[model samples]
Target: MSAYIAQACTIVHKLIDAGHHISDDDLLLAITAGLPHFYDPFLVSIDTLSDSEYTLELIIP
Candidate 1:
């Protein structure tokens, strides 16, 4: 998950350098938004969670 986030940050940084605008919130959303409906329950679970309850290990492990 660290790797995924790192790669996303890398891409986002490039996008910013290229003059496209993206925010941390946007990147966070993009990460989960790319998941298919197969993960709907998991996504919904996270949606209802406090920020501290959400962890990358739950998603990637």
Candidate 2:
């Protein structure tokens, strides 16, 4: 997780340094939006356990 986050941050930094005009929030949002498609199925399953529970709790509570 840390490595993936670091890689994303590095990519964002590179894009910024190259004058690509991407804001930090925009990069973060794009990354998050694409995460389900990019993540490995096993990892997604593991992450889903917590995320789904939190989402359900938020909706019900």
Candidate 3:
């Protein structure tokens, strides 16, 4: 795996081990914390959307 993917997985695993339920908000906070400052505006845009809207925008298949 790439370094970024490995690091992200490690973070999620640590969170899981902490016994807290992992929600979308927790994942988002983790991502925003790791990304560069240039991504802040994009992250803020995501924060403004409803959960359904955010999922739809992701276009997951």
Q: Pick the candidate with the highest TM-score.
A: 1
Task: List per-prediction Cα lDDT, in the order shown.
Answer: 0.75, 0.57, 0.64
lDDT of 3 by residue, 12-58 (tens): 78888998677655655565577788867977877887777765226
lDDT of 3 at 30: 62
lDDT of 2 by residue, 1-61 (tens): 5566667778888998998887654654555555665565744554555533533233222
Model 2: CA > 4 A from native = 36-61
Flag the better candidate by TM-score, 1 or 3. Answer: 1
What's the count of clashing pairs in each model shown? 0, 0, 0
- Provide the lowest-lDDT 10-residue window in model 2: 52-61
**In candidate 3, which residue ranges exceed 4 Å CA deviation?**
17-19, 55-61
Candidate closer to the true structure by lDDT (higher is better), 1 or 3 = 1
